[model samples]
Structures are given as structure tokens and as C-alpha cells.
Target: MAQMTAIKVRGKRSAKPQEKWTSGKKRRKNIAIGAPSFPTFAALVDSTALNRPDQRKRRRRHICLSTLEQLPTEILQDIFDYSANIELAFTSRTLWAQLRSQHVYMRLTTRILSRVLGYEDKERASSTDLAAATRLLGCKFMTWKLFRSWLEEQRPGVYRNTDQFLTAWSDLRPSMDLVPPIKLLRGPWTSERLSFLRIFSRAIENLLELSPPHYEVALSGFAEAVTEGSPNAVGMLLSMGLAPTTEMVRHAVIDSGCDKDIVIAILSHRNCEGHVGDVSTTNVDLLDPALWSWAEKVRRDGNEKGEWLTRLLRSKFAEIAAVPDAEL
Candidate 1:
């Protein structure tokens, strides 16, 4: 044992000379601790956010270490698979940067949306998995254009129109039955429709809002919004500079209970050159008794507790009624 110790001591002494560098200029100085130089929260949001949520930019990042990071890659991946909130993984820049590269997370998100929505593998297609995975990563990091190309490949035949293409490709769309309330939207819906809307909200958010001009698509998009109980989708379109057609307003009136803000938004933007869209309808005047009856029924139900809506409906009707029939 003493010989071994003597040999170890000799080895250390022999290695010591090799450790010394023959020449050196100088060692680089270390950065100061807690430099107070991290990008501000507002700056991160500005740099990371794109014109649309799906476009993100690489920005200066802040990082923190965690014990979970030491786990083996496969083990940590399994843990990530169990997490429903992808944003939680985003708490650490390293984790977000690492996990997004794993295709397994994409498959995992596919299982989540598919299991909840009851879309079979055959109907939904793998392209949806990729698209939704991009969405799950946060809107800014999404690659929806790539997803759209995949969808086109998946359905070479019926890609007739963008709206239908989206509705069909997503496979997450609410049933037609889920739209229009059972009792004329007396109040917020008490069914599964709202849940569906909220679940897929971000996925469709930019799609409806950022789409280019299309004469025929306005109503179709509005109809999709109405059925989905997501007037905000149409509202987003309005915010994106699409003019509000009366049909859009009518869709809002169909059950303003869930979409009161959409009505307010349209009226607010009415004076903007084309933003208010034409309020023209068929032979029926804006203040038709039947329409008033419908508005009264909606107001009597639960939208805005009935007060504001009732007054607005009556006042608007009175104002429009005074106009000559020819001018209307």
C-alpha cells in the first residue's frame, strides 16, 4: 500500500509539469455575476412575437437549471409526454428548446387532441398531428404554412376552398348541431361546444383573422365562428381589417349572448370607411318587427343582463325606422 501511494505521488509529480502551458497571453475574464443585463419581459414579448403568432424569432434568452434536467433523455421525455400544458415545459428555455425537437412530443400532443375530440387516426391524418404540435409549441413558434402544405398533400381532392380545407383538415371542428343554441341562445351555452371552442381557440385564431380577402369566404368564416360559439374569431377578422357585413352582424344577433362584444366591436368600427361593411339586407328593413322580436327574446334571455341590449335594440330600431324606405 505504501508502494502504491509512492507510485501515485510520483505520477502526480510527473503529470504536474505537463499541466503547465509553455506560453500564454492571458485568461479571458469571467462575466460579472448577476450582471442585471437580461432582456426585459416586454422586450422578449416584442422580439418573440411575430406579425402572426405562428412566426417567432430567436431572441436573447434567460435560463435556469433544474434537477429534472439531469434525468436521462428518454426518462425526461416520458415525463414531458404526461404534461398537458406545454407552456409549463416552456418555463425553462432549455427545456422548450430541447423538447420541441423531439417528434415524440408532437405525437403525444396528437394523442391528447385526438383522444379528447374522438378523432380516429384514419380520419384526422398524421398531418394534423404535425400541425397541432406546432400550435402546442406556442403560436409564435408554429409553422402553419408547412402544416397547410401537409394538409394539401393529405387531401388532394377536396381542397376546394380554404375554409372548408381548414375545417376538414383540422378534424377538430364542432358539429353543426353544436352551433346555434338549443333555445335561441337565451344565455351562454351549457353544452360541450364552448369547451371545444376554447380548446382549439389558438389554433384557429390566426387562421380566421389573417386570411386574405375573399368575397365568398366572409360569410363562411362568420358561419364557422357562429357555430363554434367563437364570435371572437370573426372579431379577430374585423380587427385584421375585414369589413363587417350585415350578415356578420346578423350572425352576432343570432345569439349575441355569447358574442355581445362582437356587436359592440362592429358598431365601434362603423364609421371606418369599409370596416363596418354594408348593413343592407333583403326586403326586410333593419327594424322589422320579427327582427325586433328576435332581439327582444335575446335580450330577455341573459345577454348583458338584458338592460343594455334591450335599450340598444329599441334605440337602433327607432333610429333606423325614421329613415325613408328608399334611402334604406
Candidate 2:
């Protein structure tokens, strides 16, 4: 052990030489530490002191370790998805809005899906699975369009009319399932009263066209009033527009409970310009006595309820009385 130690000390004590170089006319000195036997090149290289604080300040100026908030929305989404908790995506409208509208998350998810299972395989699968998947993805419009096209292909021979087409397509309309209700209406329905009335009128017109005559008989008081107030209502019957066939008239008068006078008013008064004729049969009493009795009762009340009831009685009488005695 003593002999090994003496050899290591002799090796350490060996001499090292330093080379001198002249640059232009100036003589530059290369100082070696521990001279004669040993020297540190590391110490020679660091003659200019390291200004650590200044170095640190320089680094800080150029190397900005930016926070996540400083990044763009696309970059932020990519960063957030891997590290963020599940609750972060669902916590509020703001988060959901951020995720759903962003292309970054969509691309990330699509990439992951493509990697796990081949993307093209999904399209080659059965149509039912595709339909369900599309619905899950909230691409309902595309789903229904595809469905309708398939249906049309299957029924190649049949050409549906406008009414039939509307019925067939009704179910494919977009629903308000995802939308919040307050955003839909935006205000109280009270302000929409006139618009409601117009819609109600149009709905009634459609009902009259599509419904059986007996269905009209079952209408409530308010509906009866609306029909009575409409001047064009009875003309729909008398002009053969209602077909005026015995069955159609009976259906209108008996089943629909149409007012007799309104029916007469539509028939006896040409163009229904509201003129009373001099003909004896044109007299209200000379009309169907049963209907006249009902009309008198309706008129006696004279409110909206009365106007409606009287109008109904008058309409029914006119419809029934319009039939020839010979036919009866």
C-alpha cells in the first residue's frame, strides 16, 4: 500500500509545459494555475468573471417560459385535453363552448379513434350502426337525409303529391332538444297575441280542409265563433265548394251544427254582400223553424257566446233548408 501511494505522488508531480502565442504587436499572456508541474485549462479559460446575475437577466429576456394562458385557443385546447380533468370539460357553458367549437379537440379525438380502430371500417359496417353512430355524434340532419334518400330509393314507383310529401317529411324536422327554451322565445307570449291569432286562423282553415265534416260538429264554442265571424265560411258549402251533395249538406248541418241563417245568408244573398232579399222564403221565420228557435235563443244572449251560438244555428238552418222539398 505504501509503494502504490509513492508511485501516484510521483505521477502527480510531473511537469507540464505552457505555449506562448503573439497576436499582432501585443504580447498576450496565458496564465496557468499551479505552474511548473500541473495546470488547469478550465481556470485559464474562465479569466473573464461570469456575471451570473447579468447572465440570468439575459436568459430571462430571451427565454420566456410562457404560461398556458398566453397560448392561442387551439394550442390551449391541445394542452388542456391531455392534462385536464373530466369536470373541466363539463363545468360550464364557457368550457363546453370552448371544447365543442374547437377544431383541436376534434382532430385529437379523431386521431385517437383512427389509431385504435381503423377509420374506414366504420363506414363499411352495417347501416343501422352507422345511423346510431351518426345520431350519437349529433349529426341528425345528415342521418335523416340519408334515411329519406334510402326510403325514396325503395319506393321508386310511387310519386307522392304535395300534401302526402309534407306528411312524410314532417317527422324529419329539426327539434329544439338541445336549445334552452328561454333563448328560443326570448319574451312572454303575451306580445305575440296577434301572431298567435293569425296562426290559429290558418290552423282552422287547414282543419276544415283535412277533417271530416263530423269533426267540425265537435268544435268548442270559441271555434264556432271564429267560423261564424269569417264571412267566407258558408260560401265554402253553398257554391258546391263543400260539394253540397245531400250527404255533404247533412253532414254540414246536422253533424257540424252549422247555423241555418248564415247558410241562407250565404246562399240567398248573391255574393254574400250582406243584402236581405224581398222573397217570402228569405224571411228568417220562414226558414227551418227548429233552427230559427235556436237562433232566437242565441240572439237573446247577445254576448260573444250568443253571437257564436246564433251564428251556428243560422248556418245549420240555411244548409238544411237549402235542400229542395222534393229531394226530402
Candidate 3:
């Protein structure tokens, strides 16, 4: 009976070992069913691809940019006012469109003209003063009709007729007490206003200092224009019927820095060919000794324009000499 019991105990131990192995298998099966499978390289790539567009959208939402055209009208006008040149508006179509209004035009013209003419109190300027200033600045775009309309808008019924407006405009010069009046007071003034301003400002200085003869003021203005290297201003002055003298030409070549465009403008004037002959007889020293030396210096300095001016002047002199005094 003792041996049978011992045998029964051994059998029980063997059963226990089998049961332990079965439990271990069951635990491993449960782990395999519950835990996630390791992802493949392609699956990881697909997941990243799915997320990229959303990430890009999030980044895009965080960044913003504003363009010049998006700015307010007042801000645009302020930009125009602060700009170095009125031509800045012409750089872009959007800018030009923004600044094309009559109100903006008037404002810019008034501001720029006042600044150029050295007016301390631009706000105190009258309609007549503004009109005269516009004329002086050679505002080609500001037509008579436009100016009239603008004037009427500013001061209603002040100018009843064109004649009254003309009278007011004409009377502006005397009130300013310009001793020797500007030659071309009328418009179709096509010169660049900025270039005209630079040259005319200097001419005004000369006018105040010299107080030259009635005819000489125009001549002096031309001289100042030429000296300042403004070809357009010189042309405008000449168109105003300024008679260029021998002394003026000589001064332009010798005294004033020889600029090609200015010299060409003077020489190319309709009156220049005839005027050259007239002056040559009166002034024996038409071609000064200094002129040749200046030409040589200009050549040495490698200024092709200056060299061309010297050549043009020489050709003019040669033509004057070839033509008899009878025709002149």
C-alpha cells in the first residue's frame, strides 16, 4: 500500500509539470494576440506622406505677407510725398493707378512746387499764387480747363470769366516784384519741372543779386540754366525767345562747365544760326583762346560729350565764317 502511494505521488508531480508548460503556452498566445505588430518601412513612409499636407497647411496659416497695392490711399499719398522724384509713381502700373486722381495731382504739385520754390508757408498760398506757381514749375499736365475747374472748386465764383482769371494770372508777376520778369510766362511749358526748378532757382538767385537790364534777365536765366547743366531748361528758356549772345556762348564753353546737351540745345535753337553771325561781328573775340584749352582738357578727361560739344561749336563757327555778312 506504501509503494502504491509513492507511485501515485510521482504521477501527480508529472501532471503538475505538464500543467505548467500548458500555462506558459497560453500566456505567449495571449501576448501574440494583444500586442501590436512591428510596422514595415513602406507603412512608415505612407503614414508620413498622409501627415505632410496637414503640416504644410499649418505652416502656411502661420505666415502672412502684404503688398504695396494692399496699402491705404492715404499711405500711398504719403509715399508719393516722401519720394525723391514724381517719376517714382510711373515705375509701376499699380502705383500710377493709385496716384492718378485730380486731388492727388493737385496736392503733389502744390507740395513739390512749394518745396522747390523755397516757400516757407505753402498753406498760406492763394489760388492765384498756386496757379502762378504751377505755371512757373511748367506743369504741362495741368491744363487751362483743369486749372479753371480746380480753381472754381477751391474758390467758388471768384473768377467769373476766363478774362478775369487771365487778369489775375497776369497780375501775379508784378505783385511778386520780380525786377526783370521771366521771359516765357505762358504755358505749353514742356520741360521737366524738377530740372527746370533746379535751374530756375539758381536764375532767381542771379536775378536778385545782379538786378540786370530788362532784356538781360532772360539772358542771365539762360546762362544760369546752361551753367546748371539742364538742357531741357535751356531749351525752354530759348523757346521763351531768349536771344543767346556771343558772350553767353563763350561763357557756356569756358566759364560754365562744358556740358554737351546744354551746348547742343543752345546751338540747335532756331535763332542760334542767325544769332551766331550777328554776335560774331559785334564781338571780335567770338572764339576765345580759353575755349581751345578747355576743349583739350575735356578731351584729356575722356568726356566724349564735351568733345562733341567742342566739335559742334567749331562747325558752327566755320559755317558762320563761310556765310557772307549780306545774308546775315
Candidate 4:
């Protein structure tokens, strides 16, 4: 009975260890079944390595953007044609190189001039646009011949008719030979000369409204030109034998917004040479106290051009004073 009992005890102990081993195996199996199905760190590293070439290719493609110089010629030309500003061509050497062809220049000039002359809208140009056009016409690329050609193109038969009319009138009346010759009126067609024509055209239209005498109409046109602050207009009138009276000079200096250009134009004229030094009959000096006062106001107002003009006028006044009456 004692041996049987001892055998039962050993069997029970061995069964207990087997049961523990089975439980451990089952727990490991459950962990394996319930684990998440995500990629391991090793798998992620391998995938990244595989995609490296594709990533490099994408970066290279992003870096290889096309530049303006690489654009097709037609596209570039279209861009230039649409850009109305002449100064745009100067922004880049490539743009300048491509756009400075004679064909482009002529087309660009014509388009800008058309806008200035109000061909598109059939209205007169605004003051701002006219000023901009004047500056554009002063560009190095602009030429008198181009402007004249444009004028003829715009008014085809008018210039020809004008010349014919002038010739016919001179022939019909020999006394009309006293008038300024056709060449002077017709012009060497400078930009300034064209500007004068525009001013004179408006002046004539204004005079016609009042129906003034021919001489008064002509004189008023000259005064209007002076007051308009256009040096070319003033210069043209002076060149056409309009004497620069003391009042005219005083009016330009004191009344015409103290425009430096207009002042210079009047003082530089051949007709003005003798009169620049002449004092007014009203005891006002040609470079009057009123003009100096205006210059001082201009300086206080921070007009650099006006200040420079004042200095020029002072120098001119000094120069005149230094010269003897014998030279006069």
C-alpha cells in the first residue's frame, strides 16, 4: 500500500509540469495570432532604398524648369508685341536683342504713337498720356523720319494737299510771298516740331471759335504755345519770326508756371538774343524781381529743376551785366 501511494505522488508531480509546458505554448501561439500586420523597421528600410532612384528623378525634374531664353521665338515675340512700354525692352539684354529688330521697332513706335494720337478711341490724348508720349518720342530709338512717316500714313492726302494749297495760294497772290515759306511750315519734322504742330492745331481751333483777326489769332497762338510749357512750341514760334517782347519773356518767366524749359527755349531763340537784356517799359527787368521771387518759392517747394533754372537765370543775368552796351 505504501509503494502504490509513492507511485501516485510521482505521477501527479510529472503531470503538473506537462500541464505548465502546454499552457506556455498556447500563450505564445495567441501572441503570434493577435500581433498587428504592419511592416517591420527592416522592411521599411528596404522599401526606402528601393524608391531612392525614383525620388532622385523627381527632384531632378523639379530642378529642370525652362527659362525665358528657352521659350519659343514666336512666344517671345508675342510677349514683346503685347508689352506697350518701350522701356520694357531695356529690362533684359535678351529682350533687347530679340525686340530691337527694325520690324519690331517700327510696329512698336506706330502702336504707341497711335495711342498718343488717339486713333483707337477717336478722342484727344489726355495730358498724362501726351506727356508720356513726349518722353517716349525723346527715346534714343525714335527718329524724325519715323514720326513724319507715321504722320503721312495717318493723314495720307492731307500733308500733300497742304503743300499744294500753300503753293497755289502763293502763286495766286504775289503779296503772300511775305508770309513764311512753305519749307518752314512743312518742317524737318522733329518730335518737338510735331508737338508744336499739335499745340498750334488746338490754338487755331480755339481762335476760330472767337473769329479773331488773322494777326491776333497768330499772336494768341504764340502766347498759348508759351503758356503750354512746351519748349518746342515756344521755340517754333520764335523761329517763325515772332519777336520775344519784354512782356512775352516776363509772361514766360513769371506766369507760365516758371517752366525751365520754356524759359530756356525763349532765351535761346535767335529773336530773343537782343531782347533778353531789355528792361520792360513798366520798369520790370527781364529777369524781374517777380521771377526771382517765384524761383525762391519753387526752391522752397523742393522743385530741383526750378532751382537749377533759377541758378541758370542768375548766371545769365550776371553774364548780361558783364557784357558792355558796345557789344549790344
Candidate achieving the largest TM-score: 3
Say which candidate scores most in lDDT: 3
Task: List ranges where model 4 is wrong by over 4 Å.
Answer: 1-66, 118-128, 157-328
Error of 3 at 222 (Å): 2.0
lDDT by residue (tens digit), candidate 4, 1-328: 4555434444434676656644656668767789545678999999898789765564443334248656776677667676667676777776677777656766666665555442332345555455455555556666544555545554454444334333322232212112221222333444545442442232222322222343353566567766666576566555544545656766876677667677776655543244553422233254667666777887898977568767766666565577543443
lDDT of each: 0.47, 0.36, 0.55, 0.54
lDDT (10s digit) by residue, model 3, range 1-328: 4555434444434677656644656668867889555679999998898789765564445333248766887898888766535666776777777877777766765554443333332224454444444343344455545555654554456766545554433332222222222443322234433322333332232232333353465565566666677676676566544555666666777787766677666665554344544534444344666666777787888977556766665676666678543443
**Considering only N, C-alpha and C atoms within 3 Å, which residue pairs clash in candidate 1?**
53-139
What is the clash count for each candidate, in the order shown?
Answer: 1, 15, 0, 0
Q: Which of 3 and 4 is ahead in lDDT? A: 3
Off by over 4 Å in 1: 1-65, 102-105, 119-138, 146-161, 169-328
Could you give candidate 1's per-residue lDDT for residues 34-63 as a string of tens digits? Answer: 324457899888886755556755676766
- Per-residue alpha-carbon lDDT of candidate 2 for residues 124-212, written as tens digits (9 for 90 to 100): 43443333332323321222234334334433435344333333323322211111111111112222322222211221222334334
Q: In candidate 4, which residue pairs get closer than 3 Å at backbone N, Cα or C atoms, i.e. clash? A: none
Q: What is the TM-score of each candidate against the true structure?
A: 0.32, 0.18, 0.35, 0.34
Candidate 3 stretches with Cα past 4 Å from truth are 1-214, 272-286, 323-328
